[model samples]
Target: MKAKIKATWVSVFLLIAIEQTIKIIIYNNFFDKRFAILPPILYFEPMFNRHYSWFNSMLKLNAGKGLHIAVVVILSILVIVFYRFLTKRIGSIKIVNIMFAFLFSGAMCSLIDKVFWDGSLDYIMLKGFFTFDLKDLYIDVFIGLMILLLFTKNEQLKQIDEKVLLKDFLDCLLNKKHY
Candidate 1:
């Protein structure tokens, strides 16, 4: 159990480290509309998301710092709530693991943007619909997986638990009749 806890935190930290490293590299080298590594599908493009800034404008008044702080605070709250829920030791709901994975990966990914980009990096352009980065993709996929896990996690477990309870109740009734 202790090892599992340590591994979980290590995984979270590793993701955070990788994300922040990429953000720092992009900020220092490519802070504008520049692309390297060829292939528009996969390269760093420096752009700001004003919609994500608390100051109503990206690259304004330490807004990045404020956003980073806000993200960190929110992530901390999520970790706490998740920990509480996991501690309940409820039925075999794999959703708890999925939630932790999404929570940590998403938080780390966004935290990197907030800390290093003065705003988010708008990389990975796709057919003029959504712009994102590798980190963003990681966060998005994990979150999507977490949502799907929510719908399916309990179905099999619910059946097993119900069967166990029914069998136990029947056994008790039969025992009482014999007595």
Candidate 2:
């Protein structure tokens, strides 16, 4: 494994631990299913969103405490497979590692909420503002960052590839102008 890969793995683990700690704290302290913490715009409460399929309309899969374990299992498998696929791509492993790290962290965060709350936690509510929990917000930010990074790095990678191709073309023409 490369150093960058090792670093990414470490980051994933750390993030997971942090997420779990937060979950446990919430579970132990406020498992009463009430909004324990409330700032003017936010509230910490337990919830249950059982609807499964996207938009929560179809597939009545339960999103309870046990569902958290299921999510962890499925997501872990996905991350491993995704990481392996990236490794096979030769030069794109670093990007994959970073993305995986972000995804892993987000998964851990949401998993905690599900496990402790017996379902997906949806405590956020505001009179006139958007509401989101810590886990959801973190995941969104991670995805946003990943997209930005991809676009920026893609431009640089394209430039590098072009330079290399131009050099190779010039070398071929100079050495053998048979065409």
Which candidate leads in TM-score?
1
lDDT for predicted candidate 1 compared with the true structure: 0.58
Candidate 2 residues 29-97, lDDT tens each?
A: 765665524565555554444342123333444444465578676976766654654454334456557
Reference-based lDDT, each prediction: 0.58, 0.58
Which stretches of candidate 2 lie above 4 Å from their native place? Answer: 30-40, 45-54, 57-76, 91-95, 108-117, 122-132, 155-179
* Poorest lDDT segment (10 consecutive residues) of candidate 2: 50-59
lDDT of 1 by residue, 70-103 (tens): 8677866757554543433333244555456556
Error of 2 at 69 (Å): 6.7
Kindly state the number of residue pairs that clash in model 2: 1
The residue-level lDDT of candidate 1 at 19 comes to 68
Per-candidate TM-score against the hidden true structure: 0.60, 0.56
